[model samples]
Target: MKKSIFGILTFILFSMNTFAQNTVAEEIKTLSKDKWQWMADKDVDKLGKLFDDQSMFVHMGGSWGKERELEIIKTGFIHYKKADIHEVFTPIIIENTVILLNRITLFAVVANTEVSNPFMVTEVYVKVGNEWKMGSLSFSKLMGPN
Candidate 1:
């Protein structure tokens, strides 16, 4: 009887832990989706808050830190006109960090020239205290159609 009771308790504990992780993952997904919109709109204020102080951004042109990225967006240097998300892969959570990949077709204006490209965007978010902050964002160009 004790063994059976112990087994049930263990299963219950495991299930609850899984549910909590799933909830956190869902929150991360929602935040990522909102981030895309914020980028499109060039909402620097919100982006500034989402991004960590030591955040890094990688692009086809080059890589930069949070301040430079914000400057680029604010000045219309690389206007993220739109992002058509093709797929959002399952996020991998490791303790307080989450890594997510998104396949997307990005339409943007760079140097006053409009262009579109397929890319795999990788985003890393780290939970700090009770909030999640973006630590890294990278764009890898894909050779294919949208």
Candidate 2:
């Protein structure tokens, strides 16, 4: 009788944990998509809020801090035309940190020309005071055809 009660309690706890993790994963996934849309729209204000103060962005061209990244978006230095997301992988959540990986074909305008490239984008988010702020964004260029 005692063993049966303990087993039920353990199952309940495990189910709750799984549900919480799934919820976090879905929330982060939505945030990731919103980020791409904000970039394409050049919504600097929203992006600024979503990005952590000390966030780092790594591009094929170079890497920079939050300010420079926001500036680039605001000024259309490299216009993010589209993010054709192929897949959003399950996030790896550890306490206050979450790492989300996405496979996408990104379209951008650079030097007055439009270019599309396949990339694996890594988005790192950290929870702060009930909000999740992007801490890092790194893009890895994929070889071969998109």
Scored by TM-score, the top model is 2
Tens-digit lDDT track of model 1 for 19-70: 9889988999899999989988999999999999999999999999999999
Give the distance in Å from residue 122's predicted Cα in candidate 1 to where it truly belongs.
Answer: 0.4
Instruction: Provide TM-scores for the models.
Output: 0.96, 0.97
What is the C-alpha local distance difference test score of each model?
A: 0.95, 0.95
RMSD of each: 0.9, 0.9
TM-score of 2: 0.97
Candidate 1 — which residues are off by over 4 angstroms? none
**Ten-residue region with minimum lDDT total, candidate 2:** 108-117
- Candidate 2, residue 87: the lDDT equals 88
Clashing pairs in 1: none
lDDT per residue, candidate 2, 1-146, as tens digits?
99999999999999999999999999999999999999999999999999999999999999999999999998898899899999888999999999999999999997677999899999999999999999999999999765
